[model samples]
Target: MHFFFHGQESLSILDWILRAAVIFIFVIFTVKIMGSRAISQLRLLDFVIALMLGNIIAHPLSDHRIGLKGSVISTIVIVVLYLLGIFLSLKWPGLRRIINSKPFPLIKDGEILYKGLKRARISIDDLLAELRKEKVEDVKKVALAIWESSGEISLFLEPQFEAITPSFYQLQTEPFDLPQTVIREGRIDFSVLRRIGKEEEWLIHTLRSSHHTEINNILLATIDRQHNLQVFLYK
Candidate 1:
């Protein structure tokens, strides 16, 4: 009877360990399949979905009667659905529009759009709090405050009288598209150059002028829209 009890205890322990290992592997696989963006730029609905998914998986992972195979299968199905949503969003613009709507304008032309706030289901107090967080005290100072699809607030400051064009509030200083070095760590990034509207020749010339003989020697380099070159040499 003692030997039988010991055997049962061992079996229970082994079962728990097996279940834990399966749960860990499934969690890692699911997270990898979801991609890093899910954690970084999560929208309101995304957060809720993630929480619910965890809750659903937790029960099967913890309960001994709930088989590992079933849990893993369910996880795979969820991941497939997520991937399908992403693919559909990419393939169909209409689907993308429906799935991920454009930002709602909270403020426009230095005036607070109260109607837009009501449409977004956000109160005036919430809007004011967001503006304050963005360091915008007066609504008149804002060119536009958009409630992004990701549930993040974006602020665009009005142009000062001195600067004829409207300036984005994110950069309180001069608005410039600082040239970013797309190529680094011995890798070539043509996409970044295309983004800045420059060619290889221009980059080479700019580097040469800055006394950079080789791309490998450059630790960092950025070009602003104003054509200003900011370069950092390797230490």
Candidate 2:
């Protein structure tokens, strides 16, 4: 605690450990307050704040003269400013446009837009690489490609090039459902089971009849909307 304010010429092992743990917890709390968007997907405003925070927080950890209090205060102020900026951008369209660049069409109707490419500051090779990532072998197959503000390329295949689905042939298909995990690591999730209108007794009986195993042996198990139970056992 004494070392936090007064500068130390050298830190002992315990001192270093204490400082690290304190900083680690502080950073986690700060990130939580800043919101998920700060780390998940960085945009223009996010990038600037991230850089500023990193530089500010890093000095306190390495330099003995730099106190944690100053860094913490600066971080809180920056986070507040960041939140305010986000709020303002959401309320004002002009400010939003200035902060977040508008998406521009890089390719349209199988033709590449050279002007858009120049505006985006990406080369032909870069465009080709992005196309390859989307599994597009030919540019002609792409109906539209936009350079998004998040530095992501959104590509759309031409109608003729798009893969056919069951709907295309007017064939009926089962409704989509996301399976819920009922048993994980040999433990039954009673809450999930009840939510799916099932009981532990029914699950145990089904496991015995279908998988020929008990709940304890199952590594993972899921039940879908159709009440289909799929079980995975430990290897």
Candidate 3:
């Protein structure tokens, strides 16, 4: 009786180990096949695939009689179908268009497209909310608004002012435009010299006046449009 009990206990432990191994293998295989994007940025198709994969794996785990071969076959079939869908999307432009529809133009030439809003399944309230998020109080200020493929809204604003004419070109001996050095990390930029109409000698003299002995010590330096040298020290 003691020997029989020991054999039964050993068999039970072996079965448990086999079940665990099956689950581990299936989980790893499914996750790998699904790709890294499954963890984040889940799309509609991705969500459906994930749900189906979970159900397939659960069935084998619950029923020991299902067999590993059947589970593997089902997983492969699902993966193949997913790959085929992706291939169809790429190979056929029309099918791709059907699967991932084009962006709907919500605004054109400062006018709201009500037809686009209906096609996108969004209401006027929804559009107003989106415009508010973009900090646009008036629709007239918006040059264009497009509902992107990712379900996000993109807005383009009209220029603030019109271009000046030749009549406005009056020269009053203003200081020449200076190139601002918004970023610097050690090396002297020759591009900046050409922009400010000054050579290396002028830059060296400017640095010396500011008590900065080396260019490496300065983190950032800028000459504004007004030709004022602004230097920031490295920390």
Candidate 4:
């Protein structure tokens, strides 16, 4: 007693499920080919594209009146647009700025940026929740808090409120020397030696004096202001 479109049966639940699976696979494959990142670090525009993916599927899956082919085409179009935006952003800094917003200072030197908070559309409770994630109980202890465009929060504490180190006890602290690895997995870093104003001959001589005739036997070696040629040999 019932009639069907094009003399074929209306799409069933199984048909809908299969169509959804195919679309999902297609979307994932397309994203992978584009070298897209995971959703967690997604920017606002990226999140919107993700939601568009769901939007394309939701209606067709629920309503038999909606065509699956139409949904698939629409989803592809949206994805292509997203990919284009990503490409253009890389080429043009202006476009990149539009896509990824500038980092807003939520806190500066223990002072809250109320205007920025409002612009970011986050409540004080939301800000506190983010701080709590960093294990910061008191806002006054924080020196800087940045609202990154990627929806990540960065916190910096004042030096006075920073972690207690051996230097805190007035121990003989070495001058600030960037800890550079001079050797890793038995490979020497000649560039690091040049930066530290040391010669390859000096390093070879030092290793020989320490009874390390072969650089390949060394697992790690570091040079800093406080020490010279710290070598860790393989067991």
Top candidate when judged by lDDT against the true structure: 2
**Tens digit per residue, CA lDDT, model 3, 1-235:** 3432243433344443444345444554565454323433344345545766787789889998665654566566666656776788789999666545577799988898989887666778988999999888888888889876556778888877224645467745656565577438866777877876888787778788865566778888788766577777788
Give all TM-scores, in the order shown: 0.50, 0.76, 0.44, 0.52
Query: How many Å off is the CA of 218 in candidate 3?
Result: 24
Candidate 2: segments with Cα more than 4 A from true spot: 1-41
How far residue 45's Cα lies from its native spot in candidate 3, in Å, is 3.8
Q: Per-residue alpha-carbon lDDT of model 1 for 167-212, expressed as tens digits?
A: 4444466643546665576454788788778888887887787665
Model 2 residue 183 CA deviation (Å) reads 1.1
Report the Cα lDDT for residue 158, model 4.
95
Candidate 2 vs candidate 3: the TM-score winner is 2
Every candidate's lDDT: 0.64, 0.80, 0.67, 0.74
What is residue 164's positional error in candidate 3, in angstroms?
A: 16
Q: lDDT of candidate 2?
A: 0.80
RMSD of each: 11.6, 9.0, 12.4, 10.9
Best by TM-score: 2
lDDT of 4 by residue, 1-235 (tens): 1222133345555444445455444554454333222334676556666766778889889998777876676576667667776788889999787556678788998889998787566789988998899889999999999877766778999998889998788788766777779999999999998887888888888889876567888899988865377788999
